[model samples]
Target: MTLLQSLIECLGPSNVLTDADAQPYLTDWRRYSTGCAVAVVRPASTDEVAAVVKLCAKYRAPIVPQGGNTGQVAGATPDRSGTAVVVNMQRMNRIRDIDVDNETMTVEAGCILAAVQQAAREAGKLFPLSLGAEGSCFIGGNLATNAGGTQVLRYGNARELALGLEVVTPQGEVWHGLRGLRKDNTGYDLRDLFIGSEGTLGIITAATLKLFPLPQTQHTAFIALPDFESATLVLNRVKKAFGAALTGFEVMSEQCLSLVVKTFPEQRMPINCQRPAPEWFALLELSDSEGGEHRRDGFELVLSDAMEASEIIDAAVAASESQGAAFWHLRESITLALAAEGKCIKHDISLPTSRLADFVRDVDAMLLARYTGLRMMVFGHLGDGNLHYNMLAPATLSKARFEQLEAQAQALVHDQVVARGGSISAEQGIGQRRVEDLRRYKDPVELALMVRIKQALDPLGIMNPGKLLA
Candidate 1:
């Protein structure tokens, strides 16, 4: 039998899928690209993964690594040649170890992010990285994208939480750097190279993720603001008052919240008032130490002072855990709720926190003026300056026509972002979707350097071709 047939048979019928079996994972996130692949190989262990990679290298067959398949960008999907083999990592879902003493958890790449968070919580610890896709997204994909979430204000991004990694390079060699130690002054930080490489440099098979002590107390509050500017003021006030204790600070426009209530009737808004008067709202969370008597009082005091200073119009703190979860559900449901409306041109960009208000105001004015009746749903981790600025077409525009206008709208918005010293793609890496557009914003010198590195690591250019770098 040929190497391809041998691989399929050796990996087991359940693990190897072709044609109709692999169709679900081949298309783009929104069913955009309907590519073809020879087979989708799911390996349950690192040894099996290495063997498959070696076989692919011998056969000179291109390989596409996929996890969860929940990414917005087309990074995980393969090309149309129908010759490449896709290595799906979902079968390797396992939490190998949770070392509380070392403050780290060793997990296989296929483990779901929500599972990791639960394992940490069960061990009397916390894995603070969280996003809407946490339930379905894999930790490997999270590390590959170096994902940033709501708690980036308190904790950091995925890159920050990862202490070490075990990657399978393009050459079929396993680089084991899964050390849980915090202090390691080695020559070069090799692990950093693959963390956000988006599977172009290497396939992340497993990772040793850093964990944090569980917060003894958490205080959540939903507040109403006059506008984005006042929201900024309230953020500054809380930061000055609580400092590192401020775990989450998110902002949402009234239009965005209204869409959530309309899309998901089961979900309720936090505020009990009959009418939604505020143009903007903020969700604030504070995590404090054990027996922290001062946390709740301090949070209340800060809000009172902000109200007295007119930074905030009104606010409500969660009196129970269920109430807090309800408030967070409103924030987490923003993206899904919006998706239910229609086609959306989403931009996850970041700027300096101090300039966030100005950025939003300027972008809003520019888009509204160009596209009449356009709906801009703006909200995100305001404390971290990363805004999920999504533009929805008017109900009148068909999906096809709306998508046709996407490129033009993206250019207009991205140019303004570049001029303001912001990133074109913030938390989301430059996958197939934004590779070409990145060239417009990146410096030629830096772009050349990245190209050189990509060439050095992936000389054959078979690993995740046409991704990240053009």
Candidate 2:
């Protein structure tokens, strides 16, 4: 029988989608990349997944392992060959175990991120890997990308949060390495290899994730700042004041929040307009084990001192949990708002915290000087030095006309990033979107080692071909 027929047999006919059924799985989340597949198969268990992989290996058909279909970089989308089999893990959604005493939870690859967070909450613990697509993104996808979200400053990325992983190799063998121990210096860390491999190396079937005690009290604040320098000052001050209690420190350009308020009329800005509108804003959170008025008083006191020091232009502290959510809602709405406006040139970049201020000022001037009608929308986890620096075309330009400028603009931004000891792709892994950029900027020696590792792990290269490595 053919590969399609074999896949259908392994995972019933209903799970083996084709034609229109397979269309949804072919396109990337941003609709930028679309490819055809022989069949899209949903496997319910690790054994079933291994069976599918073995069948594909026997057929020599390319395999693209997908999770949630919510990736921004087309990493999960199949290519246009129409000969690849898309093995989706949505059906393997299960919470295998929750070790509350050890503060770790074992969950299947297909568990939705938000569902995992809620599960931890029910267990009176916190799984702090949060992002804009948490509602739809899967745990496996997060691991593949080594996703960095708001709480990354405190808890760390998906890689650090994960203690163990169950992966099916490109050769169809299952490596069950789910050790929940905090310290394991056994040998070559296969878990770290697969965590950010973007599914090019193997299929991650499940993981044991780190968890933390739920804070007794959490406070959120929105501060309007005069400029990027002042924002950095406020960041340093808060870092000194709160230390580990500071859960997150996010920064947004004035244009970013204004776009959110304009696009989503229902959502209100947290800051009052008694002071002149500021150029930048910082949204920070403090999580404390100790509750009561003292925690909040300390938070307010820091902001008051910052305002007095001119580090802050104005401040709005959340009075309740709902208000805190609302404050974050504004921050989260940025990408959606940009999507609504038009095509955007995006750069997920990170720099030394010290260099961020000068980098932004210099790059902003350079881009505006070169391009007449480019609008900037910058924001991100300032605490971690990752910024989503994006640009929109003038209203006069059509989609095609605007997209033509993407390559040149991206090169300009990335060149500056590399010059100042920064990364072109920070939290978001270099999927199909930034493959060429990775090739262009990555050090020759480091790139060679990566290629050798890819060859060593995947000899056939039938796994997620044309991603990460050329």
Candidate 3:
């Protein structure tokens, strides 16, 4: 049998998927790039992965590395060629080690992010990298994208949480660097090279991740803000008051909140009393080593001071864990709620914290002028200046026309982002979807350097082609 056939048969029928069997896995999570692959391979161990890669390399077959396939930017899907072999890492899920004493956990690439968080919690530690996709996204994908979530204000992104990595290079050689050391000061930080490369440089087989002490108490509150400017003011106030204890500060528009309530009736808003939906809302959370009583008092005092300063319109604090979770649930469900709407244009862009309010105003104004009656849903980790500025078509526009204008809409949005000295693609890496547009924002020198690195690592251009640098 041929190498590809041999690979499919050796990996077991269950682990190896192809044709109709691989249909679901071949497509992008957002259903944007519906590509076909020769096969989707799921290896349960590092050795098996190395063997598969070696076979693919011998056959000169391109590979698309996928984990959880939960990415929004079509990063994990294969192209339409139907010649690429997709390496799906979900079967490799395993938490190898949890060194509480060292404050680190070594886990396989395929492990779901939520599972890792639960493992840390069970060890009486905290794994703070969080997002709505935590339940379905894999740690490998998070590392590949350098994902930043709500708690980035406190802990940092996946790149910061990563201590070491075990990667399978394009040549099918396994580079094992899963050391739990905090400060190695090695010659070169090679692990970082692959972290945000979106599986172009290599396939991340596993990683040694940093953990933190679990917060003994957490206080969550939902507050109404006059606008994005006031949301920024509230964030600054809470940061000054609580410092590192201020764990999460998210902002949402009244339109976004209203959609969530209307779309998902099971979920309830967190306000103690209802008022005309304010222009904007903020989800503020605080975590401390102190007990619940101290956390409650601290959060309440901060809100009172902010209210006195007129930074907030009104607020409601969570009285119990369930209540706190409910507040977070509303924040986390924002994307899903918005997805229920018809055709949408999504932009995960970032600007300086100081420029965010102005940037939003200008972008919103520009888009409204170009696309009349467009419904805007702007919300995200306001603390870190990353907003999921998405626009939905008015009920009048047909889905076909809405999709056809996506390219033009993206160009407009990206132009504004570049003019503001902001990133066109923030948390989400430049997968195939944004590869061409990347040139508009990326410096030519930097792009050339990236190309050189790709040449050096995957000289044959066989490792996850048509992604990131393209």
RMSD in order of candidates = 1.4, 1.0, 1.3
TM-scores for every candidate against the unseen true structure? 0.97, 0.99, 0.97
Model 2 RMSD in Å is 1.0
Model 1 over residues 1-470: C-alpha lDDT tens digits?
66668787669888888878889889866565667777889999888888888788777777788888888778888888887888999999999999999899999999999999999999999999999889999999999998999999989999999999999988889999999989899789988889888998889999999999998888999999878999889998889988998999999988899899999889877775446578899999998876656778888998999899888888999997789989999999988887788778888899888888888888789889888878889999999999988888877787777877788888888888888889987798888889888787899999898899889987877787767884
Give me the runs in candidate 1 sitting further than 4 Å from their true place.
Answer: 1-3, 272-276
Q: Taking the tens digit of each residue's C-alpha lDDT, what string does model 2 give over 290-332?
A: 8798979999999999999999988999999999999999999
Worst 10 residues of 3 by lDDT: 268-277
Name the top lDDT candidate: 2
Estimate the TM-score for candidate 2.
0.99
Question: Which digits, one per residue and each the tens of the lDDT, describe model 3 over residues 95-154?
Answer: 999999999999999999999999999999999999999999999999999999999989
Clashing residue pair totals per candidate (backbone < 3 A): 0, 0, 0
Worst 10 residues of 2 by lDDT: 270-279
